[model samples]
Target: MKMAGKMDEEIDLGLAEELGVEYEPYKMSDDEVIEALRQINKEVPWEIPVSKELLPYLRPTILCEAHHPEIREEALRIVEGAETSIDAAMMIFYYMISRIKYAMEPPKTSPDALRTRKGNCFTKAGLQIALLRSVGIPGRYSFDKTLLKVIKIVVPREIFEKMPGKFTIHQSADAYHIERRKWIQCDTTFDEGLMPFPYNWNGKTDLLLLCPWWRLGHVGKSPYFPVNELLGRFKQRGFTKDFCAREIDPFTEHLRTLSIQELCKHYKRTLGRRDADSFAHILYFHFVGHFRDVHYNPLFRYDTNLEDLSDLQESGLRIFEPKYSVEKFEEWSVSGIPFEVE
Candidate 1:
């Protein structure tokens, strides 16, 4: 089901018997099974004080510094008027997707994200998890594998063709909803203007704007910062700063050529627009950062460009990999029926 310790490959569950793993059948009436599924899908109101089992998600890791004073303060400031945990989470989600600048360079840790307001998907997920944990909400990360071709809609053909990998890691943060007893997945990697999907999170549905385009396949869930493992993998694959520049610099140059209006119009046509006017205002801000700093480019913000922070990424290597004891994922049976584990 898994390949070389990477994302799981979809397989026929009936082959489990062939693989020597015993297959188990469901024992319940159709109505009972339907009721059980409804319970799984039910949206219950968020309640306070999650169980002790969720402690792993509440604690701080090197990448997710929930215990840091700065993280706590910023979290409190962001959710000042929130009455419930769900409200606080929604507030945090909006702040992350709107205020924070998406970049692939350094300052990836939660505390660093608050300091710089910039990071890639993992680091952004780190900030989200840290902020939620700071306010006593259990938070974790879910990983997926997205093909590099998915971003071809945004990136120019020349740049897309030259990019290295076939697939890359995509990540999102999860907030535990106590009443529902489930973690709601929220992908805050793309800012509001950049993403065509409506900017909304109801503390129930998954907010993955890019999933519709990326054709993402599930990897696994982790209570700890899985970026460490990713960093290690990148090192194993010989990914370096210069190599990143090879792929990134060309895209950055291309952005310089296009006007903001052109960029918006291009996005509207390829990715659809969330509003009436092309997202000119948002693209303006994006251009401001892009022009001011050569490191900034909207097209490949999802790609984690390790321009600097080699020390932090190196330090995280192998230190924060997730253990199966605390991981959660949707499971399937031989009959193709799904099951949940907590």
Candidate 2:
């Protein structure tokens, strides 16, 4: 007899064959996918009712908690109040990106996500979908591979020799199908400023590396090893808890051996070291580049004609224009996610 709960193992193979890939792509026909997911849910070993397992992975923690009714209400209110197409689109996008914190951290527990105001891209996308759907707007989530290209004027040839590939970041964009217009792409995570395009770097090429940013639960098994494992590796690298919080390390081996004692020592030492600030600045810059590589590189090209808020205003929709600057635009920190004009 086939072992109980073995259907999941077989489902993977079946899905792979259907998609013609090595792994399931998370794109499934609506009904078929739902039924297959139900079967997979039944196979889970957790004591929590399998029905609860169907909840979206990135849903807001406040929604899950008993006391935080305001979050859901506020989200619904914003959606209900949207008057024009632009307002609805902007409000949804703004709410999605602002609620989630940007971090390199792995998936969070439901409680943790509820307590903290930040999360990785996956969580942000999921929450956006849920909030949109809750308000009766038709929203679906999907992932695509994005190529990030960075152009530097005078980098050493040695750097190119060391690494060369299109850096790929997995991003999630949502679409709303209005009666007149077919589906249009609305990016929720980063500011939708002028969508960056591949042509922006024309004639100047320095380096390209494609790192995979797998959308959570969409791609095959995650490459994200646990934090504890990373802590252990940090110790091996001569970095101790005194250097940083064990929980903050993203590399698996370092997280594994991280200890509170080491952290205390590192914290104390970091207090007086003037270099600490500089070190942090350098680290932030490096991580920012990595984040850009994974999140912003493969940019969506928007209509250049729709460049200014005046266009929307001329179209008779209320538009909120925040102060704009070149630095902010370059960093993709344009306006907060767009929402319906209030």
TM-score of each candidate structure, all chains considered together:
0.58, 0.35
The whole-model lDDT of each prediction reads 0.54, 0.32
Model 2 RMSD in angstroms: 17.1
lDDT of 1 at 197: 19
Give the candidate number with the greatest lDDT. 1
After superposition, which runs of candidate 1 have C-alpha atoms over 4 Å from their true positions? 1-50, 153-159, 211-213, 233-261, 268-342
TM-score of candidate 1 to 2 decimals: 0.58
lDDT of 1: 0.54
**Candidate 2 residues 256-319, lDDT tens each?**
2433223223322433223223322332333234334432222223323323435434543222
